[model samples]
Target: MNYRHVYHAGNFADVVKHVALVAILLHLKKKDAGFAVLDSHAGRGVYDLTGEEAARTGEARAGVARLMDLRDEMPPALATYLQLVKEGGPARYPGSPLLAARLLRTQDRLTAIEKHPEEFAALKDALAPYANAAVENGDGYARAVKLLPPPSRRGLVVFDPPFESPDEFETLAQAIRDAVRKFANGIFLIWYPIKSQAAADAFTGEVLAGGVQKALTVDTQISAPEGNLDRAGLLVINPPYGFDVEMYAAAEILAPLLRADIAVKWRAGTP
Candidate 1:
């Protein structure tokens, strides 16, 4: 698997995913008890939108760049996301780990896992400033599962794999199964490309088949795909209360800028 997230770092899908992540983490923080976050397939943590890879695709221009002026009137989730983006500066973007790390409170902890050696090294440096965040080099899926029922007992497991292999969906489904079996109460966020709606739904069904109740899906369709992946979806198992509301609010702001048609649906239990 030679796939890298740098080229597509700050696209429309990423905007939605990261916004949802912020909402979830914020929800987790409301409680006094500590919560953990596992970022599987963690990238280099930070991305340079002006770099060669990002410029080649220019995905950021249509994604986070359009939200540079996001105002305080926006929902807290979007506002927090915008603040983090701004903190990274105009030419840089924060990946999941960096975003998650920055959001971590003293009581909360973050474990970021990356499969690529170089990405893992960069991940370490990116998270070095955060005493609450740890970086690991290994199979993100397996390592994340092994860290199940984290010491905190409550947490979020983020699976944002590259989906480079043919059995990517199957692997993701199994990982979710393992997560549910070991840590059913934990919140799980899984991202996947939607080249085929039917296939994507089937994969979602498989994950729900693992007995994941209270799950919701957030999807964005910027355009009908012509083989360049114009659509992607995120599955949130056990999403926090009002999570849908926050994501929808952020989507409304994002839709016009991206010309995207975003949908939020329940795959299992209701809000």
Candidate 2:
């Protein structure tokens, strides 16, 4: 409950997550049928990159700030993400909800869940203009399961928990099991901080044991080994066709700018 994303908005991890998100959303658009999106752990729909929190951390300076200058050099997916960030204005960056809202068609729907009171209020206000989207102040994990098998029958579910609780990883794994049981075909994306290679391996092992098919893990390490979070990863279950190739290409482009090592791999059960 104490975790707030304002300080780390648009950091290297955000770049990786949002870039992959943009790619997946674009893939969803290829079909004529409208699709829904559930943004579990959606923060305030937008963040101020120049705000006090952002300034104090200075994370974006080494993250989004570096990419803003290389617009033309980015891959199509990453370029699209950067353009969305730029459209948010000079000092602001769009969170997952806002980014998803921008890509949603009239027939599509988006539900953004935020449990934090103040953040929920802000999220409601930020998403007010989108009639196709709704902002709910509730537990994202619980809401995710309750809202599965959406009316559209085709959708994406994003889990971006804060990892504030010691058991968050286990909790997330359980949530995945519950959600997959209800909507087996739904695309699931889970993001986690990579503090160490061993920890990441253990988590990935647990997820692989969950029996999800076509799971791909994408990660980037921006700094040399230290006792801090210089790396982050995303686990995508049932990713879109060709998404793995596109994500690897995007990570290659982002690695040098952020001084990160990129690792792209297919976990067990992937096919």
CA shift at 52, candidate 1, in angstroms? 1.2
lDDT of 2 at 104: 92
User: What C-alpha lDDT values do all the predictions have?
Assistant: 0.89, 0.87
Off by over 4 Å in 2: 224-228, 269-271
- Please estimate how well model 1 matches the true structure, expressed as its whole-model Cα lDDT: 0.89
Q: List the residue pairs that clash in candidate 1.
A: none
Model 1 over residues 1-271: C-alpha lDDT tens digits?
A: 4888888888898999999999999899899999999998899999889889888887888888888765647988888988999988856689999999998989999999998888888889999999999999999989999999899999899999998998999999998899889998999999999989888989998988888878999889987335567999999999998998888888888899788999999879887
The 10 consecutive residues of candidate 1 with the worst lDDT sum are 220-229
Our model 1 lands, by Cα RMSD against the true structure, at 1.2
Best by TM-score: 1
